[model samples]
Target: MKGQDYYIPAAAMAIALVFKLPALRNNWRDPLLRSVCVLLTLAGAVFTFAAPPTIDAVNEWTGIPNFSAPLVYCLMTAFSASCLVLMFNWRGGPAEEIRATSRRWISGYATVVVAIMVLFALGDAPEQRLRDFDTFYANTPYIRVMIAAYLLAHNVAAMTMVAMCWRWSLQVRGWLRGGLVIIVAGYAFSLTYDATKMSAVVARWLGHNLDDLSTYVAPPLASAGALISAVGFVLPLVCQRTSDSWQTWSTYRRLGTLWHEVQSTAPAGTPGVRMSWWSPAEIRVIQRESDIHDGFLRLGPCFDRRHRDAAYEEALAHGADEETARAVADAAMVAAAVRTSAADPEGTAAEDPGEGERVLIMADGPRDLVRISHALRHSPVVAATRRRATTADG
Candidate 1:
């Protein structure tokens, strides 16, 4: 493979390792996270060791020509085994069930590793073959069998990961689903790597040469698969935080107008004089909601139940759905509250759940608040109510 080809997986592996370091350090007890970290580290090593320059250097340092060939292949086999083990962990079941299944896969791949070593010992390959290793050793004694065994092991692992990822993704959603699909796509490229290498080996057996396919086609496929698989494993954890930040920021932005309108009437409701520029979006949303409710409480003396009822019926008459009408009514009430607070900021009256008003239990949570915020932005009924309140005050 070209130097550039090796650089891609190397870069990907480095990024994955850096991204996962914090999780690995803090959550070492998590089996799945540990497995993913090991998988990425091994994948990077495989890419680095498989590069032609590294192979040549290792051969010269060890004073054994072609020694790095089997060493690199062995590392590749270990990388594949780690990948399957990671996948098994990801498809979680009961602890005992997973342990038993994982042990079996470990034993099976262990046997493959031993067989590869034995075959390499008995084989005769004096030349250092980098890109065309499969075809170069196709007719060599036990080396031929060893090459085939390694390829077989790789293909099996790749296929198993592809199938498992596909099935697992179907059962999940959001970032996890997208991550698994990307993993499946990676292994699909692995299948291509296996196909091209095997075809070249078969061609050698038939006394013909397809060295170009193994040399030119297979390494790129392997490199791409490793990079993608590593990314797939990391995507969910990274994306979860990213998606949350986006949603939180969106909520903070969307509620800005409503928060500003209410806070103007109840300056005392604001708990702080200075807002932190880098405060989390969730914190900002909670603070804003608190200010809104505090302002609403201050307007209790001016809250006219009849006005809210009229707004609700008007929203319904305008063909708003039940939920929409309720939201519009809530927005109108808040708008009126803002006006009332402005008219008499010092009015002292216990906040009453107006007649026909839904007594929103604490369990109702943020749904009602969100609905009212949405209506404040787009509900025509809220605008009409504000106009009526203004005219009445005048």
Candidate 2:
């Protein structure tokens, strides 16, 4: 169970590291990102050391008797410290407060690490006890206290995170709230891990074997908790980025019909090579918006205010709201302009005073442009106005 349990956290740790690598590299100064990276690295190291197969390999290569034991214990202590620091950094309070909190956690955990090393140094385990190190060393003089100390530290960190998350969860919402809840659940399992292992150790001291609790029961709980905690940390960032990309892509696709219609009237406004299907949503949206503005600029002289006014009245008659009617009126003028520009590019001129030089609709942003595009594509008033202008010219 110990060896098999390692793989679950190992995979999760790898995924977390990969996901945060860009943030880690690009924004190394970001405290939250840095803390998360450190936490994940320590977690991976703990899992790597916990596995008997990995411990044996390192022991054989290093030729240090029971070296993996101290290494694993130290790594676990560091993992606990990193986890707490990550929580503090994640739940930002104030700059000075964060620094003070971080400094205190570091100083306290450093003392715990030193104590674990000293206890390992005092213990005499000539042979390796890979599978049942805690049970085998349960009665060994200073080693017993050392194991107890490490478990104490582990339990303290677990309880602290659980309490912190539970309290903080009440103040947050959406992904952060949900994440805190999952983290609390994971830490609940962590507390179970501590209780079960401590029970096994105490049982060994009492001249009985509850080794199965440590060997069979606690490892899976620890593994499950670690995996869930990692996911809880990463879920918000991953889900948000995914949602933003989906929205950008949706907006890009929805604007396509309107962009095509305007682009036909002003072919130069079409971004032929740059507007490929392979282009990123952000780039395509920018280019599409730019081209729509350019196409409207070219159609300015052809805009007829009377035609726009008629379209607005017709839109109101069709039960369109004020905003929708305005958008329909603008789209109708653009459609009529496209026909006028197509007929006589040189001869086309607006007869209305001071209206010929003004830009059509202005575009403004994606929302305004999208609304106009929607009216151009689907509004019956825009189509009717376009047909009336075409007939008048004929």
> 1-394, model 2: which lDDT tens digit per residue?
7576796678779787988898689899999889888888888888877888988988888887788887888888888888899899989889889989998988898898999889888888778877778888899988899899989998999999999999999998988899899989988888999999999999999999999898788888887787788778778767777888898888877778678877888655544645666777889888888777777777777777777888899899999999888888888988888887776667435554644344457656887778888998998888888797788666
TM-score, every prediction: 0.79, 0.85
Q: What TM-score would you give candidate 2 relative to the actual structure?
A: 0.85
**Top model by lDDT, which number?**
2
Top TM-score hit = 2
Clashes of 1: 0
Error of 1 at 74 (Å): 3.3
Q: For model 1, how does the per-residue alpha-carbon lDDT over 24-119 read when each residue is reduced to its tens digit?
A: 898998888888888888888889888888888888998776778778778888888888878778778898887788788878887888888888
How many clashing pairs in candidate 2?
0
- Residue 140's C-alpha lDDT in candidate 2? 95
- What lDDT does the true structure give each of the candidates? 0.79, 0.83
lDDT of 2: 0.83
Model 2 poorest ten-residue lDDT run = 347-356
Count of residue pairs whose backbone atoms collide, per candidate? 0, 0
